[model samples]
Target: MEYKHVVNRIMLMIALFISIFLNLQAQSISDSSTILIQRNLRYADAPLEIGQDTSSDRLLDLYLPHTKPMQSLPILVFIHGGGFSGGDKGAKGNVALCKEIAAKGYAVVSINYYLYLKQNKIQGASAGANMKDGLPKDGKFHTGLETAVKMASADTELALQWIKNHAENYALDTNRLAISGGSAGAMTALYTTYRSKQKILPIRCVVNFWGGLASTDDIRASAPPLLTFHGEQDDLINVAYAYALHKKMKELNIQQSEIHILKNMGHAIYNYITKNEINTIDKFLTSNMPAYE
Candidate 1:
């Protein structure tokens, strides 16, 4: 009887040890899976030049994923809004957005373009007031604005070309590129991708946040797909621009284009980007430019 009792106790100990070992193994696997799913992203602030100009306006900031995937990653080139006379690549708002995009597996680059009003000063009145006055008698006013837009577009195009040339060094997928910006920056992006004569990598799509073109007449069947977000109550650039562009795209049978007119929203769409909007943008990008793998 004593021998039998001792044998039973030993069997119980063995079972307990096995159970503990299996539980520990399961926990280890769970921890590792969590770690694999969660990754850290990295960033590089401005002073990174993308053009021949050494001025701050020609600089850019970059955001990269933590882990380098086997395949090159798609990139999002962001332009900042300052009415084509201001704004920076390191602007608080732009940096935040770039980080968010990088976390989602995209390499993001925010660039600075020469401001139209910076070099050409309209004596006395501020840029805002001058813009409101419309075509000043001195003629510098209208010319400045036009030159600003043209320079901005040229700088953006040069930046795109630079990215393409250095894509391999940065682990970027040059073929799967997207351009985005807010307000004035959006205008620059639109013009650079659609109107610039200098050929570069084909833009897969565009994200226009309250951005408009001087004329949609230049839009062609070959224009890239577009996703526009505009507030119905936008006071700066009329909501008509969004509607007009949407109409043109439809007329041209551009099937992948979409415009989301947020009710009661204004020019500050960037401040109001919700999870639903992010998800929608993600879906659009994914559908248009799938991951390399």
Candidate 2:
């Protein structure tokens, strides 16, 4: 009897140890990966020779996955939005999204565009030195929504052209490409996706998170599939803009546009305002979209 009891206790200890070991190993495999990408993905940091200052307006950050065997991967370009007046490509907010997308087997690029460079000049409009009209329109540091959109669009087109001329070097599939953005960045993605007439990047789909859409006819013209997420309670860049664009796309018979209006969400879905939206965006990227005709 004593021998049998000892044997049972030993068996129980062995089973517990095995269970703990397996659990830890399973966690190690299920958690974040350790794949390290060691190569610099080819990308031009110069502005398009056509418009804007190449010195300040041109600069792109490319992120590539560390997948072995070097298979050709899809592409995703992200444009950050700081009201188009101030935003950096190196911000943690920008790179976090890029790295997340890259982990899912895609190459990602983040771009920085010219900010509103208006120098403070309290002249003519100062009136009697106490006349406050609105906001300072310093020539060296100023930008509006329309101007920002145009400049960002130009920069994006230039990047697309660069990729088109050198896709093979980057190990990218010319046929599979996508664009995404937050706030002004979202506007940039939509405008860039629809405005261009050339097939430089051949964007397969788009992800617009907390961004507005312009009335650019090209959105309806190309009508590439789009997935947009916006907060219903957004104060800046009203939610109506999203629905308006979707309505127009539908009218133009451009199907395959998905819009997720998160309840009680606000502007800046991926960054400061609403961080949870980033995971939702990731899920969208994971689910493949149907081929465009």
Candidate 3:
């Protein structure tokens, strides 16, 4: 009887210890993860707009935590989706996403890059066609929509460069950077991270939302970890690309990737980042990233 009593007492102590440890961890996360926004920080001068340098279209909103932890925060550079011709860093949905991610102890930069406007606009009819069939030109002549995408990717690269240059100002860890976007923004993210003609930054991860690749051949063993969210019924970008991405990663022995296909969903899942997905992203960024760039 005395032995059983001692055993029960030991079990209770272990349970208590675990509870205390978990509570401390929760407290730590809650304490250090409030958001602080530095709005409309111009990452670049507008080279395309008439008013150019004064235009807000070239700006970025930096979302970060109130408390800078011992280690610097990893950055997530977001591009908004408007078929490369529209979308803003301060859009309602974009703002919500930036804040939600910033609250997750990350530094999020939502950038407003150059867009295809006026005579440069690629009509909607061919836009979808160009998305799947118009990339990896590898020096082939670019179509209107393709050129628009290229310009957007270049702007995204500039944003990343800007973040790297201003890393110290925001306590950011450029070595652990990730790029993310929805629709057209997702395409820019993929291209900027993978198919850029010049050497882009060594991206640690990619968050693809209903995005496709010009060619899966661009992805190789050295590609960064990718987390894709796709809608099964998405007509704009289709869900097949997500499946193909998963298959290619498997073939390359790249284990740090995932594809989440939402049922009965469509292209504009801009507001789809939920608690579960956020947890997955947090784990992917922390667990999948290697020590080096």
Q: Which regions in candidate 3 have their CA more than 4 angstroms from the true location?
A: 1-33, 50-56, 117-119, 124-126, 129-142, 197-200, 290-293
Residue-level lDDT for 143 in candidate 3: 67
Q: Assess candidate 3 and give its TM-score to the true structure.
A: 0.79
Per-residue alpha-carbon lDDT of model 1 for 28-53, expressed as tens digits? 86544322221111222233433433
- TM-scores, all candidates, are 0.74, 0.69, 0.79
Superposition error at 185 for model 3 (Å) = 0.9
Residue-by-residue lDDT tens digits, candidate 2, 47-81:
33425443245667777665542556677888887
Residue 238, candidate 1: alpha-carbon lDDT: 72
Q: Could you tell me the TM-score of candidate 2?
A: 0.69
lDDT of each: 0.73, 0.64, 0.76
Residue-wise lDDT of candidate 3 within 1-293, one digit each (tens)? 99999999999999999999999999988655577788888777767554542222678889888876668888888888877656677778888777877777789998887776422644552346654433445533236766777888888878877887888987888777888998878878988877886454568889988887756887879888789998888776757778878888889888888889898887767667754477777777777553444
lDDT of 2 at 117: 28
